[model samples]
Target: CSASSGCGTGILANYFDHYTVFNKPVQSGIAVGDFVTLEISSSELFSRAFMLYIFPILALFMGSYMGMRLFPATELWQISFGIFGFISALLLTKYFVK
Candidate 1:
């Protein structure tokens, strides 16, 4: 959407400028029309990032540990349960994001 009406254009522009994949500097004042944008605070973005990235790994580790504890001699069970836990964490994250 155009910033002519003074929406969140600045915040979005600044975010893109600071956080591009190639680390190239981006100019501000870029605008898009017909594109939906959700406004979120930086802290919220970081929190969500942590949940999206870190939570699944942590869940996998915990799940594998628990699986091992439950089935000490079964290596397959540990791997299967770890993968299951990771997927479940991701699904939960998707549901909460929506």
Candidate 2:
């Protein structure tokens, strides 16, 4: 066994040390999944939602489109990007959310 038993606990612990603040916590409430909605002119809320939720989706779509670029599209790029993004987001959510 490596020093930490190959458990990745050191990396995991470091991840929480850095990211645990970005996610809010809720226990047994309707507000658990609720993100504060933005008023029309509120750029900060919009930016937060885009950064946390929408931008990644859009980027993946763009990645696939850019790969095709008016040619017949292939599944290779989309699949690879999707798998990578899923793994990344899983780690991020685990790290940031208690």
TM-score for each candidate, following the candidate numbering: 0.59, 0.36
Best model number under TM-score: 1
Candidate 2, after superposition: displacement of residue 63 in Å? 0.5
**Residue clash pairs of candidate 2:** none
RMSD of 2: 13.1
- Show where candidate 2 strays beyond 4 Å: 1-41, 70-73, 81-98
- Candidate 2 lDDT over residue span 13-87, tens digit each: 555544434444444554656765423467865665556566567656665565455444677766666656655
The candidate that achieves the highest lDDT relative to the unseen native structure: 1
- Roughly what TM-score does model 2 have, to 2 decimal places? 0.36
